[model samples]
Target: MTSEAKETGSGLTAELKELCQAVSEDFAMLASLHNKEPDAELLRLLRDERFPEGLGLRLVEERGAQAVAFMQRALSALPDQMGQADLDELAADYADIYLNHGIQASPLESVWTDDENLVCQDSMFQVREWYQQHGLMSTDWRIIPDDHLVLQLQFLSHLFAAGKTMDDLREIARFMDEHLLRWLTSFAERVAGRCATPYFAGIALLTGAYSEELRELLVSILDEPRPSPEEIEDKMRPRRVEEPVEVKFMPGMGPVV
Candidate 1:
């Protein structure tokens, strides 16, 4: 290659690396917000004037101004100095939205994708397989299913941070198409509608918008066209069918052969 061509390639690689780092950080932030109730450290960060603006600028560059606007509104609604009552309210909102048995909005992918709207379904196992392929697994599937939104976000963060080649970007894109993008928008919408706090609602909107924009970015980087909804559904269709088993009972005793 010419010297100029080499320079161009180097520049592009540096730019992509920077973008990946930023994207990874963004995913980590989203994961942290969703993982639990707001703690003092988080509240302190929210109170810091630079935090929202910095985050907003990064988001607006990829997503649009509307994404930043939602976040600003939510942050503005928070008390200048949070007290016990404020913390309690936030905790309750989190529980109602994510933790409660009668959760208003579940963060598990299987709950949204399964036919019966239950957790620990086929999607959870599929996501576990994805994790295992990367030499990672949840500490306990019983406590936190593999397809939980927080875990999925953390996985994307890991992928971006470790991604080194076009193949890695393709894998990230494929994972989002197969997993995150499939149910994230619906989950965000549900959270927005059901959550009491503007904070959760705003984050939901921002996260959904960010994921869509990130997918577009990956497509641009890889020079690949995104699949349509129908195409994705076809791709995601179950690959195996289980056959039924018949059992015969006799008058003296139940028997199966």
Candidate 2:
């Protein structure tokens, strides 16, 4: 590659890292807001932006689609507009779905990963390693679990700040390809049909969108040596449920042959 090409590649990589930071920060803010009810000003903004006239409506609609897709798997997915009673009901239902089904709906590592055997290298398993390597513990202060998307975003945030070497950038890129984006697509697909509420449904849709953008940005940073873009397909495998898996139940956690 010419010196100019090298400089361009470096520039692209920097842009990709910045994109990752943007998406991560967006989700981190969301995770915080999810735990707390927004004040009147925020609520007014949400309502206005959600209405037909707001200029940024498409972004909201696109994200809404992702959320509904995620929730429609198990429940009667609805639109964003709902009364206070509906909101309460939806929240309660979501809580139950999360509690009763647990891993059945979303599996943390240990599921679909055979890291213990040392013969396979699932990206999800790699994320666990990354967390421990960075000394990110799962204490109560952490709002999300160890493997949640929000936490992964936080990890990337830390990486972006401490990044000083090309090796650091490469490591971060590897983490994105192997871990965060690797399993999240499949994970989101599984979640799409699990909920009935439009709110979470919107979340799922936006979640997938966010995941797609993040993955593309990371892969772009990778700059494949020979393989063309056409060769790459979706990064996740389709999940099948034989029995009616309960909440919290995860697949592929047992011993690998």
Q: Which candidate is the best by TM-score?
A: 1
Residue-by-residue lDDT tens digits, candidate 1, 1-257: 00111111122387788788788888888888888999766877865764445652155454545766877877777888888998888899888877894445789988887778888988899888888777778877788889999999999888777777777788899999999999999888888887888888877878888888789878888999998878887777676677887888888897875
Segments of candidate 1 deviating more than 4 angstroms: 1-12, 49-52, 61-64, 101-103, 239-257
Which 10-residue window of candidate 2 scores lowest in summed lDDT?
A: 1-10
Candidate 2 residue-wise lDDT, 1-257, digit = tens: 00111111233356545554555455554444333333344444555554212312123345554453443332323334556776566556456434344325542432433335222235444565676676555453234345555556567666654554556667766666555655565655655556654554444455556555544444555564422323222333324458854455348675333
Estimate every model's Cα lDDT from 0 to 1. Answer: 0.79, 0.48
Steric overlap count per candidate = 0, 23
Superposed Cα RMSD, model 2? 12.8
